[model samples]
Target: MGQGLSCAASQDHRFFSAVHFGDLETVNAMLERDPSLLYQTTYDRQYPLHIAAANGQIEILSMLLERSVDPDMVNRQKQTPLMLAAMHGKISCVKKLVEAGANMLKFDSLNGRTCLHFAAYYGHSDCLQAILSAVQSSPVAVSWGYSRFVNIRDGRGATPLHLAARQRRPECVHILLDNGALVCSSTGGYGSPGTTPLHLAARGGSLDCIRELLAWGADRMQRDASGRIPYVVALKYRNGTCAALLNPSSAEPLVWPSPLKFISELNQEAKALLECALMEANREREKNILKGTGYSLPSPSHSDDGTDDNISEASDTELCCICFEQVCTIEVEDCGHQMCAHCTLALCCHNKPNPTTACLTPPVCPFCRSTIARLVVAKMKDCNDADQDIGDGGSPKLRKSRRSLNFSEGSSSFKGLSATFGKMGGRGSGRIAAENEWVDKP
Candidate 1:
């Protein structure tokens, strides 16, 4: 009784300091002198083995385990030494802990994060491999070590896979995917528009990760609670390469319903709208110019020329506003305004240079200049909100207004609403022309 009490008193005094200094010899001598001291814990409920493993003291860790010290004893924080070992990338300590049958799937008290969650998060591939091997051999569907393996969410419902994707660890993503992590796990944080791993990949700008997720059957059109698609997310970030990748037909035109077809249809609708607008503007100009003035009848030479020929010629001379180049193709935005094709393409990208001033992501309706979605704040409410009416084909219903756009008045060289046409004031005699229909020759 006296020997036991003396050994206990001596160990109690040295326990905290010995563990802190990683004194394997003192720890072994104490354990040898009193075998029961192996179970003696510190104030924080950490066994000698726990501290050794946490601090990456592999020699002391191995000795403690060989003497039958419990490897699964958690600290007051409810974190096993294994959790610390994995998190800190201690390969040898991780191996000792795993070999000792430490609870691989044990969750931390606070975040409910498991050891694999920690290992994968910190990119400890060797330790992760050991854990996976142990996991595969366990009887439970999710190994007991991973029983709480971060497959489920916290109060917010973000899974471990979600965290990995967000952290942008490609290797971690691969490991999780190989270990059967769900690709489509959703969170309440985003509502029905909860972000999938692909969403995280999009946010991380990992093109390879994005492709891998897609190969694993990630839905490209899967929208978040706000109905924002992956490509739309890419656009808001100004990732043009991703935007074009999502829409295969953007580079080379594809068949029906492709980006090209979609763009073409939108262009036609915009042209029809522009044609009506241009006619009105032309009438106003003619009325303003001819008002209170006596005009002579046109000569036979002028009268015989084709009106269509002149309008076609005039349309060809109009330059793209953003690029200052002659327009190639054109696209109309939700705001009922027009821009060159390249400018429209640039606006929807997340990777193009200098996008804020030149690009037009949604929520900033390209034409009306309204903030569609606040990119800076990451708000991606669906373009078709209940408050905003979407027409038959998911296009927003344009608000009607008397404000009309005039080609000459808005043109760079047209100089303050003058009705007189200069000799070199572009091809058409007096009218706006359709796209690609501009007359190249008289």
Candidate 2:
């Protein structure tokens, strides 16, 4: 019975070859000569759709779909073309299949994993996000619910977040968390059965993944089925840097500010600014945690173009009043007070959210007691006497503003962060002004 199909569609060998190698010309001629080739399956009943999709032959793929090829067509193992595209990290093919109305919830028999699972487990974040974006508006989301589908499990009861963490895919972990995957959900079969995403991240020894998971509220204290916490798992895997962060004795991790509607809803630029500030501050804190240990900090995990970070830039308004060493580029909305992005982050991250808490108190402005509403990239102001030499024939030159410095040389470890935090929130009026004048005397 099988010998006949194999003998007849030995022609399938040619058709698959053309689709796989992206020979659109040959494929078109073959289709014109034998229209049945477009719909024929190979010896294993693999559709032409799977070959074109897996090989990333977008031109041939689009042609197949145009000629009534099913995007969701599967082979013996029940693996669809969309799943194959995601498995191979073929983002364009994934998008094409998605646009052609492939079923996102279809699970392959080998692993009981959907396209999302394949994308995450294989570290294809772009493909993962594409599937998630489609699920948001698809009828499947309404029926199964969006968040539920995002946290959907595979045969081993591993969520996409768990797979991303175990595979050291930090960006995929971040994407899953952003799309409502539960950060602290425990696995049923993956890794230690009861292992959480944090546990898997610790075992994988990816500090970047740990940062992403912890910032999204992953519980480090959560235990696996064998009663071992993430810290123990980190130490078990010999991940000293990860162990240091997971250590209960170390300083608290900086969490993403999700309570402050203003901070949480900031635009992409502001968000990136806050993220860099958070990671840098955490890096500095990690130094203390690794004081006597042999482990050192790793290279930064993501690219930072530093469009708004100007601490080292030669701007007159570089020093922030709060930190006195960083550029004051972020502004509080209604209060109109400004501070360095780092210190601004410090205030928000000072209070870490409890993963089990239902509500949280939003942080207040240090300068004023007003509820901190929003943060914006403060516009650069010319804090210098730009018109100092504008006088025509010495018609009285303008006065120069007192030069601001990165605090003073030989200052204490904590400068503006000391007891003088809020008293200097505003420009000092009488006493401090007189002191400034006395100190600036030539």
Candidate 3:
């Protein structure tokens, strides 16, 4: 027994050293001498496969897999070799492990996070795409459905989307969204309940991430457990640009001439004419308003005796002017008038018209007859709310403000918006034009 124990220990030291340094020849020779050395665990319970994958030794990893080593063997943290490879951004190693039948859906017992989650958290876009492709092509994924693994949530109830957004991985965010990852999925773990990917993006101050999420139909009006929407979170973190983009007032209102006519069906010439007309009309209206000669449009009325009724309504200490239920926690921009974030977002940003209109109406301040420039999240004093604690120890924490908005150096361009008629022949326009043909037919 003593002799066997000594031999195993000696073999483990040499095997671990060889795998750690990626000495392919030494690893193969040792494995040939002691076939069982491939399965031997180090002091940390990490196998030769885990070491090779972690260190990005693709050649050694390939050799181990070809020798029929267990691909799914996990370490003390319950992290498999595939997870290690993904977390370290070893794309080639990850692909090899996946092709060799590594368990892609296996989650770490500690956090219940899958390999995709690790790849996303580490900002490995290529690694993430490879894992996604492997899953889609796998027979098990085909039988069980790819979404089952793609949307797998961690113990904290956070999906891979949440991690990508939180880590400010714009490429990973786009890849995940393109693959049908849920945008509005909320988390109930790690002191964050009902926190969506938009909230995470806002907190991280990732403008590209925010844009991607919004383009993918993320609900900005969705609130966290603290009753704060992504816009409010952006303001709280001083991400002014993100907040402005999310503000409904910043979007130009599209006025359709006819309810039956679809914007997509309009030909290039017709669309140009309509745009010119709208521009002329806006210029004339602005000039008239500036000259005080324009006809008065219907607006909210003020109170008699020189007291603003709107201000009074907003200043109601007992009730919120927007929701009329919850207490006020958010304040409108440029006007100190208060309202709940939930109500502010719903009243200003989420008020969608019928399908015929297909336009977004800008939100105005209820207390003041001015257009809402932006919304600011007021800092609460002595608040012990669980949602207020947004730290996860090792992950990126929300900052009061960032020096710059340029998070990702990659291209910021994304396709999903309604294509303009002028750019019909451009790249990505073919699909949009094809889809709109049915609208113009008959």
Best by TM-score: 2
Q: Model 1, 49-165: lDDT tens per residue?
A: 777777788888887788677788888878898988888888889877877778765668877777777776677767766777666666434443342453656435667667666
Candidate No. with top lDDT: 2
User: Each prediction's Cα lDDT score?
Assistant: 0.53, 0.74, 0.64
Find the 10 residues in a row with the least total lDDT in model 3.
400-409
Q: Report how far residue 430 has shifted in candidate 2, in Å.
A: 33
Clashes of 3: 0
TM-score of 2: 0.80
Task: Residues 1-442, candidate 3: write the lDDT tens digits.
Answer: 9999998788789889889898999988887888888778888899889999999999999998888888999999999999999999999999999889898878898889999999999999999999998888798587768877778899888899999999999899988976778878899755565889999999998866876676556776788999998889988998765676555433322222221223334445434433333332222222223233232323221111223223332223323433333345566557766554333433432234455866544455554545665555544433233124434322221221110122111213211111222112111111112222211100
Ranking by lDDT: 2, 3, 1
Off by over 4 Å in 1: 1-22, 30-45, 142-155, 188-193, 234-442
Q: Where is model 2 more than 4 Å wrong at Cα? A: 1-7, 189-193, 300-318, 351-358, 384-442
The candidates, ranked best first by TM-score, are 2, 3, 1
Tell me how many clashing residue pairs each candidate has: 24, 1, 0
| Candidate 3 Cα outliers beyond 4 Å, as residue runs | 1-11, 188-193, 252-442
Give the winner by TM-score: 1 or 2: 2
Taking all chains together, the TM-score of candidate 1 against the true structure is 0.47
TM-score of every prediction relative to native = 0.47, 0.80, 0.57
